[model samples]
Every structure is written in structure tokens, then in C-alpha cells.
Target chain A: MIPIILFLAPALAMALFIFRSKKLNAVVICLYSFTHLACSVTLLVHPASYGRYFQVEPLNLFFLVVLSVVLAGISVYNADFTLKSAVPARKSTYYSAAVLVFSAAISGVVLGANLGMMWVCLETTTITGAYLIYYKTGKEPLEAAWKYMFICSIGIAFAFVGLIFLSLAFTGSQPSLFFTDINAHAPVFNKFWLKMSFVFMAIGFGTKAGLAPVHTWLPDAYSEAPSPVSALLSAALLNSELLIIIRILKIMKIADLGGFASAFLITMGVLSVFVAAVYIIRVGNYKRMLAYSSIENMGLITISAAIGGPAAFAAVLHIAAHAFSKASLFMTSGNILKRYYTREINGVTGLLKADPKAGWSWIAGFILLCGIPPSPIFLSEFIMIRTMFGRGMWWLAVPVMLLVTIVIYGMASTMFKMSFGNPQKGISQERFNILNYAGQFVFIAVLCLLGIYMPKAISDLITAAASLM
Target chain B: MTEVLIAIFGITMLYVSSTSRVEAYIRVLAVQGVILFLMVLLDHAHLEVLNLVFLGAETLLFKAIIIPVFLMFTVRKNNIQREAEPFMPSFYSVLITTAIFAFGFLIAFWASSNASNVRPLYFGVSIATIITGLFIIISRKKIITHVMGYIMIENGIFMLAMSVVGEMPMIVNLGVLLDLFAAIYLLGLFVTKINSTFDELHIDSLTNLRD
Candidate 1:
């Protein structure tokens, strides 16, 4: 089955990482990404061959495509990122292994028909990411890694406990925990236990997804990780966690508990946006600021998912747009970090003058991130707001619109401060690798095109995916 | 027979909490593994024979023997005898752990009204043990003791699962057990690294990043 490749490509890549040269690892990752991308496209066009445990539903197919594309982009960028590494030998193996492991894990989460299997993959991703987060091996990275493990491990443990509670809700026949079986029989589950399970799962997985109130680990982990890892964490890893929550959301829909589940999600979603917006304005680290921005976007998706109906459409679109834009932004941030040799907001200036490619990418990324015109994120945000207003939930739209505005202002201010000002004297002129520039260019180009238009096949996939939800 | 094994499981945590010696904590984990293996054999009469054998061997080999061997290696490698610098005083930790155990017992008793569905005693003692394990994790300062606390929590979870879902598939059980062991091994290795890096096992030193 194609799903086997989806899982194995990464595992094999990890093994190869241990033995192969750095150049070989890069080629392998690129090959895996291409293979993964090709399989996802084929799966989207013809769904018959897809296995039950690893079917490519339209929504997941969209995510698969985004994941593969971003990974491929990161792979190319990684070729250069590795060169800039002050400590290459010790760090490269871990980085490659993480990519391969994270890819397999993400694909597994996206495609898994069994909840228990998906949980395993999600937990596996968390463990694999530990190396990536601790790559720097500095005081900050170590601290970040510890918090990342402890918090995520506990959160995932809670998710397992939720799985047990969900299993407890079954009454007749052998109690099944597979997603397909659970969905089919969800309507008959004991309401009390089902709701309790949902609460626990939402909080548990939400922590991994970087949803607010439980998102304390995100800023530290994302800020401290190497840029490419930050990109993966923000763009790909979080989506898999979201996929887990979406699986439960599907169950809620099947059980006709949408009303209850939606209420809970809306509360968390709005809180995430408000908290992120407040934090974004004054973040000291540029990477942490972007991390906060990611939290806000994820919050938007959550709120949109809670709205259901057409809003699910918006949620899917926003997820895609956010993936591309945020990946581009984080990758470009890596460029800035390499050039400036510092992540502090005050340490670097005149980004445009120093390196136009990285600087413009930063600006363009911010524009896309803030939902500026012609960007897919803007289109998605528009649709989400319209969906809310059309449903006569004008009150719900208020905080979303207000928080987004504040976020826009905050991001704009940060970009302005970092981009246009005079370059600090005595700043060393660093050589930007051609491979890095090409990767960023490819990423930004893809993002721009996706914003302006989506290919019909992908759009159809998105529509079908939304209908399933 | 399972009841006796499960009771020993609960008592092990009390011993783990009251002790300052990290080596004793590792020993208690080995004893708990033996207790769990016996408990599984005595209680899971509904499980397939092959699964029971597999579970029995796994608990005996990995849980009882292999993991404890690794922890002992880590113990010897680090040369850490006692985690004498607990975050809280021993007396306070003991009192807090006792209170948590009592609260867990109350929860189990209150929730286990369906007598035929699950055993009240199994639920009560397992919950108490889990809470006490968590108490150890919180009150201990050393990473080694933290790992022991994690193992204790895992054991308590395994007992709870055995009590409630006696007929879990072999694959699920194996995966759960393997994952927990891997987590403990990784955490233990990290503790050693932390010890070597900083020359102290105190978790407080890992607090450099903040808003």
C-alpha cells in the first residue's frame, strides 16, 4: 500500500541518516518528499487504492500535499542551513532523523483510521522532536527541550487516558477504539462519558496543537529550536495534532454532539486568539513572536472548525494557507538568524539592506501571515468572518476581528522595526547560499500561487474533505 | 492472589516515597514489575493464553529484569546513591502523598458503584498508587527520582488497565508497555546526561528560558 511508503520513507531515511553522508541525507529527504508528494497526488486523483487505515480523504490530502511541499522546501533549505551550522557533525544526523521521523509520524496521524495507532504516531513525533529542539545544546535549548518533553508527555498521557474513557463509553459487543468503528457507533455512546472524553482529548491534544491556556510550551520550544525545526513544528507537527482533534470533532458530528463540542471549542479558540494577540505585541525574540502568530492562526482554525458548516471550509483553507505562509516565514527567519547571528528583536536591523532576499521574504511572509489582500490566508479569513456573520453570530465575530487586527498591527510593527532600519555598524557580511535562496524563492512562489488560485483537483479535494467533517 | 500482588504494588510506592536512596527506588520498580507480572497471570483469566504468556514474559523480562538492569547501570554510571535534596521535606512529602492516596481511594470508592463492571478494591488501590507516584514526581528534586516516579505512575496505570480492561489485545498491551519502557529509558539517560553536564541532578538548573 502507498501508506506503507508514507510511513517507511521516513523510517528508512532515519536509518540512512546514521550511515550516509550529509549530501546523501539531503538527497534522500528530497526523494522521500517527492515520492510522498507523488503518492498524495495520485491518492487524491484516485482514492480506490487507499487503505482503510491510511485513506487520503480530501482534507487530509490537502494537508499531505502541504506537508510534502513544505518538507521538500525545508529539505532544500536544509542543504544550506547545514552549511551555516557552527556545529555541523553532531547536529546534522539528528536533524535528518527528525525530518524523516516527523514526516512518517505526520503522515501516520493524517491517514490513520485507528485512534490508538494515531496516538502512537503523535506521541512518536513528540519524542522525535526532542532531538530537534535540543539541537543547539545550549542553556536555552536544554531548558526548552525539558519543558517540551515534560509538558507534551503529560499532555499525551492525558490523551491516552481520554482514549480509555472513550473506550469505556461502548456498551454492546466488544468495545472498539478504532476511529471508524467509534464514529459509526458514536450516537449510542453514553453522553456523559463521551463528553468527558472529548474534554480530556481536546485539552490533551490541544496542548500539542499549541492551543492557548495550554500553549505555554510553544513559545519556548519554538523560539529555542533551530529555524528549520521551528518551521516543521509550526507548519507540519501542529497540523498532525490538529488532525487528532479533528478526528474527535468528526465523532462529535456523527454523535450529534456538535452543539456541545462547538461551544467548548469556541471558548478555547477565542481565548487562544486573545492570548496570542496580547503576547505578540511585546515579544523580545523574533522567533517567539512568529510562534505566537502561529498560535493565533491555529486559534482561528479552531474557531472556524467550531462554527461547522461553511466555517469548516474556512478552517480547511486557513490551515493550508497558514501552513504555507508560516513555513515560508519561519524558513526566512532562519535566513535572518544566520545573517544577524542573533534572535533578539533589538540586535538586528536593516534586513532589506543586508540581504534583500531574506528581508523581502520576511516582509512578504508577514503580509501573508497577517491575511493581507490576495493571500490565501486573507481569502480564508474573509470566508471565516462571513461564515460567522451569516450565521447571525455577530458577537463571535467581534473578538476574532479585533484580535486579528491587533495581531496584524503587532506583526507589522515587528517587521517594520526589523526590516527598514539602518544596519548596525560592524555587522559581518555573510554569504547567503544559493541553495537557500532558491528554496525560499520556491516556497514564497508556491505560497503566492496557492493564495491567488488553487488547482481544481486540490479545490475539489478540499470541498470533499469539508463535506466529510 | 492478584489482590495480594496489587497490594504489594501500592505499598511499593509508599516505600519509594519514604526513602531517600535512589537505588532503593529502582529496586522498588523491579519489585513492582514482578508484582504486576503475577497480578496479570492471576487476574487476566479472560485473555488468550498466548497473550497471557506474552504479557507474562514481557513483564518478567523487560519490566522486571531488563529495565531495572538499565536503571541500575545508569545508577552506577552516575554514582548517585540518595536523592537527598528533595524539593520538599521528607515529612511533608510523605504527608502529601498520604493525603493524595486517601483522595484517590475516595474517588475509586465513589466511582466504582457498578460492582460487576469493575473491582472496587482494584480501582481504589491502583488509583491511590498512581496518585502517590505523581506525588513522588512533584516532591523529588533529582532527575533519577523523577524517573522512578514516572515508572511508578506507569505501573499504576498498567494495573488500572488490567483491572478495567482485562482482555486488551496483545498488540496494544505490548505497545503500551514498550512505549513506557522507552520513555523511562530515555528519561533516565537524559538524567545521566544532566548529571554529567551540570554535576548535579537538580531540575532547578534547567530553568533559563522565560518570557
Candidate 2:
């Protein structure tokens, strides 16, 4: 029942976006975010089901909380981000509406108990997200939106084929599309079709998760979108995609094909990390650099998920930790973009002199992303490597660690070049809004506190989520 | 009867690949939707009246009527160039699609040899159509043609779902159809905007965003 409000909140907001004056755009967005945060918290505290099609299980519970938290932060930032913009009022109005729909689609993806429902919501994200990317109405945004939507649509089509294959595995009276039903009966399913289904779904859902080879659109789309949207894309959208994969992985485990699923995920994970390591070095666009870092983080989480057990605990923690850390970085990047008016790494320097607050946030975001101590990423990477060694996956562990180190440098060099230099002459000296920093400040603080100490409730939630995986 | 309709559905992709005219692709989609409607009607004859009506509305009104109409409207409104300007020649495209069809046939025969539950023909044709749709998307230079390829893949998915012995709920089917409509409408809107922005549906002008 509470899940219905998550869906309804967006509808209400969309109504306000259409009927009300533009002034209410921020208020409507803020209201919806509050509604979103409220519903997810209630749902987590008191698990509820919306018929058989939507349920708040341990796995999605963790992802839902992460998404709501990220949305809450992005909403606050977006309210200010829209206040003064090069973007016209009409365009920003549509942008606000699209963001609402995008967040709702993601929540739908996370809440769906039925795989079909999840797939629908997943595709909805592609549509809404494409519009959000194209909000500025120009060449680059169009191209980015086109590539993102077209590629993801095809990926989604393949996933539907996978769903068909899943039905093929059931030879009896009726095939079920519900996740729990599939999980319950997977042991008796046909092995050949099960493997085939897994293959197609991995490629299908993996594409959306920005897993490598199929991840060609991630950099462009992430780099091209406005910073608030980028934060949502990096923090919320990708998690929903990975959550689907996690659900599929659980099904694979139930069928005693955990070995196959684990190998497949690890291979994809390393490829994603390697792609980041290769591409991040050559990127001149700071936003694209951040985009590559996102891919690498996603790869790390995937590897941890594949490793299972306590490593899966690390995976869940890293997902939450990375969500906050990355969102803050992207939001801070917005601040830098507004002042400098360029995305190129060489376009602006002396970020510290220009806006010390943003500059420090950027540095702090880099440190958190690089997995230094007091960042949960450090703990996750440590556990991931120790577990890989414990499992005698030396070959996998060593290369992933090396590639990740390279990725860290790729981001760090870009960060230092921008953060420490003199603020470029002739930069815009527009009055900076304190509200612009609201989201990033809260995100950084929460991330730092979590890194220092994990509350029992959150850790228990993480453990429960991991056990399901 | 359904098998015959399914085979015709697979053959439609061959036409899709062989043609240079984008309108023909849209026409083929309309034909495939009609084919799908017929197949669903024949298959679900015994379903409840409510389910039957909804399914009919889905494949007929939504799939057959709405999509192709909007697509044709988009093409005409944009005055898009009729030529698909595919990356490869039509000859190679035809050959590749044929090869894909043969492979699908082979897989259908091989996998279902021991299983009575397999509807080999539908499985083969749907798989073949899906791959061919993907081929069209990658090979074609026009964004409109790419959309046609997407719709083609969607038709293949509908056929694939129909092939299964047990049925997915009508609600899921309705959801897919609705989502497909939304996707097409948005894509069409973008295509129009893209046409105006770059002055054509050419993919070449979209090269600015690369790393």
C-alpha cells in the first residue's frame, strides 16, 4: 500500500508541473522527494506488499533506501540548481517533470515483485532519462540521449527475450513471472534454458548496469546530463539495474548454478574496470572522467557481489557509500561548471580560489571515491581482496586491484589539475547560493560518519541484503 | 494457423532488410502487428471475455493502429528522405538476414528434438526476427529506420510470448504495449526534433560527443 504512494507521488508532482506556475517546480520536486523518503522509510520499517506484483524484500529494501536517500539529496540540490540557469524556464520545467518521472521509474524498478513489472519500469527509466539528458536542446545532449536510449532500448529488448527464455524453462502447467515463484521453483527448471536465460538476462540487464562492452553510452550520457540528473543516474538508476542482476543471480544460485553466475559476473566486472582504466586516462572532460569512475565503482561492486558471503556485505555497503560519495562529487561538479562555464579539464583552474567550499567538496569526494580510510569504499575493497585471496582467486584479485589503482589515479590527476590551480580569469562571478551546497554537504557528512562508524541497524540491514544475494 | 502466421512474421523481416525505403519498414510493421493480432486471436480463443478484449485492444488498436500511424505521421511530417542509406548494401543485408533465419531454424530443430513442449517453428522464427531487427538497427544510417528496427524487435517479442504454451498475464502484456507506445511516441518526438536540429535524419551530424 505504501508502495503505491511512491508511484502516486510522481503523478501528483507531474500534475503540479503541468498545471501550476513554474515557481512551484522546486516546491513540487521537494515535496515529492519528501514523500519518496517517507514512503521508503515506512516500507523499510514495516514491510508491506502491493498485491503480488510489489514487495519490500531485504534486497530491494536496501536499494530503495539508497535510491530515496540519493533522490532526497538530488532534489534539494536540483531546487537550487534550477533557480538560476542558462536553461530557459520552459525547458527547466520539463526537466523538473522528467526528473520526477525518472525517479519514479527507478523506484518502480526497485519495488517490483514481478520481473515483468520490473522490466517495464526499467524501460521507463530509459525513456524518462533520455528526455532529461536532452533537456538543454542542443547537439551534444541529443546525441547523448539518442545513443543512451537506442542502446538501452536494444539491451532491454534482449532482456525481454531473456524473460521469454525464463518462461521456456517451465515445462509444467504454467510459467511464473514473479521473482519469488521463479526462485522457489528454479531447482526443478530445465538446466539448458536456465543457462540460456541467464546469459540473455546478464547481457540485457548488464547493459543497463553499465557493464562493459555494452557500456558505450554511459560516459556520454552521464557526462552530458545536468549535474543533479547525473547524480541520480550514477547513484539511483545504476543501482536499480544492478539490483535486477542481483535478483537474477539469486535465482541462479537457487538452481545450483552459482558457479556459472559468479564466473560470468566477475568476467564482466573486470572488463568494466579495465574499460574505465583504459578510457579514464585519455578523457579531457572532467565530467566524463567522473563518469568513468562511476563505471569502475560499479565494476567493483559487481565483483564483490559475485564473490558472495561477507563480500556481498561489502558490496551492499559500498553501494550505499558510493551512492553518497558520487552524488556529492557530481553535485559539486555542477558548482564548478556554473562558475567556469566549460566541461574541459583545461578550461578552468584554481577551483579553490574561486569557490573554496566547492573545491574542498571536490577534493573530499575524490578522497572518498579513491577508498582512503574513513571511506566505506576502503573497507569494501579490503574485504573484497581478502575474500578473493581466501577463495584462492589470486589471478582475479591481483589484476582487479591493479586496474582499480590505475582508475584511482585517473580520477586523482584530473581532480588535482582542476582543484589546485588559479581560478581562470573572466570567470562568472554570479552570486553563489548556499542552498546549492545543501545536498553535497549532507551527503559528504553522512558518508564520512558512516565510514567512521556503521550503526548496528544499517549493518544488520546490509547483512540481511547480502544474505539474500 | 498460428505457425503459418508466425512464418509470415519472420519473412517480413527479409522485406525489411531488402528495402531502402523507410516507409516500407513502417508498412511491414503494420503488417506484422496484424499478423500478431491474428495469431493471438487464434491462440487465445478460450480466454475470458475481459482478457480477450484487452488482448485484442493491445495487438490491434495499440500495436497495429497506433504505432504505425504515428510513425508514418512522423516520416511525412519531417519530409524525411525516403532512402534508408544503410551502412551496408541491401544485398549483404538480405544475405545476413537469410543466414540468421537458417541458424534459427537449425537451433529450433536441434533443441526441441527431444522435447514435446517445444513449439519449434515459433521459437525459430521469433529468434530469427529478433536478430534481424538488431541487424537492421546497427546497419541502417537513418534514425527512423532504427525505430522501425526497434518495433520489429518488439513484434518478435510478442510472437515469442505467444509461442509459449502457458500464458503470461494480460496485465504484463498490457504494460509492455503501453510502455512500447510511450517509447515510440518519445522516440518519434525526438526524431522530429533531431530532424529540425540537424536538418535531416542523418546519423553523421551526431558525431560531436565522442571522447
Candidate achieving the largest DockQ? 2
Best by TM-score: 2
**Candidates' RMSD to native:** 2.8, 2.1
On residues A1-469, what C-alpha lDDT tens digit does candidate 2 reach at each position?
4555556766765586566545678778888887888888988889988888888888899999998899899888888877766666667778777888888889888988988889988987888898888777688898998889888888887887788888878766478889878988999888778888898999999989999979999999988999998899999999999999988998999999999999999899999999999999889999899898888988999999998987999899999988999999999988999999999999979999899989999999899888998888999999999999998999999999999989988888889999896786889888687878888889888888888998999889999999889
Q: CA lDDT of A288 in candidate 1?
A: 91
Docking class of 2: medium
Interface RMSD against the true structure, candidate 2: 2.3
Lowest summed lDDT over 10 consecutive residues: which window, candidate 1 chain A?
A: A48-57
What is the TM-score of candidate 2?
A: 0.95
Give TM per candidate: 0.92, 0.95
Tens digits of per-residue lDDT for model 1 on A164-203? Answer: 6677667564667677789879988766657867987998
